[model samples]
Target: MSRFEEELKRDKFVCSECSRCKKIVWPPSNYCNKCLNETTWREISRKGKLVEYSYNKGECFGIVEFESQIRIVGTVKGSERPDVGQIMNLEKCDYDGDEIFIFSSTVQRNGSQNS
Candidate 1:
């Protein structure tokens, strides 16, 4: 198995498709924030498009998400080289022994972005 797949399986992190509307309600919810219907856990591609982003200008801040109806946020990782509208894939990371997803990323060379 690939490293990503191995890590996912080891961590037992289910994607939880949750809803078709594509909104991530942290702490998870029984119903999707947009669709408001029952959701099922599914493995999401560890890749996604960076719709919006900002920098702390050298100051470290807590995780923050974009204003898009569906938001994605997590601990800022690496050198903060990503810019708004960049597409990237998740890298293996851990927070206090808890596996953290998507350490850092940049725009894919192909220019294709995923939601």
Candidate 2:
């Protein structure tokens, strides 16, 4: 398995860091977006909040922001409807034979939209 795939399967989520600037590059890149230096893999929080989202039919996708730094874009699924600033947890999911990533939110736990 490729390093990216292996990291996803083992750690759930990851972001790359620029060797020189030490800043994280989301969506995993070959090099830093700012400094153009080589990047290394780093594990991130599995939990975060939905900063923005939209869905077509039942499939949902959005940008989730971590507590401190970094944000990632990916699919999400949950019992209650998704909305901005809702807490969610990232997880590995399956789409046909491919390994995909998704988020399961616990928004209702905070006392809103229990559906």
Candidate 2 lDDT over 8-113, as tens digits, reads 6664566788889987886568799999999998777788878988887777888888745677677887655687887778866333335476888765566776
Candidate lDDT scores, in order, read 0.50, 0.73
Please write out the lDDT profile of model 1 over residues 1-115, one tens digit for every residue: 4333444645433444456766554444567766787666554455455655555667322232333323455544666556655545555444344435553664445888444
Query: Which residue pairs overlap in candidate 1's backbone?
Result: 16-41, 16-42
Which pairs of residues clash in candidate 2, taking residues 3 or more apart in a chain or in different chains?
A: none
lDDT of 2 at 83: 73
| Model 2 ranges with Cα > 4 A deviation | 67-70, 93-99, 108-115
How many backbone clashes does every candidate have?
A: 2, 0
* Index of the highest-TM-score prediction: 2
lDDT of 1 at 51: 59
Residue 38 error for model 2, in Å?
2.6
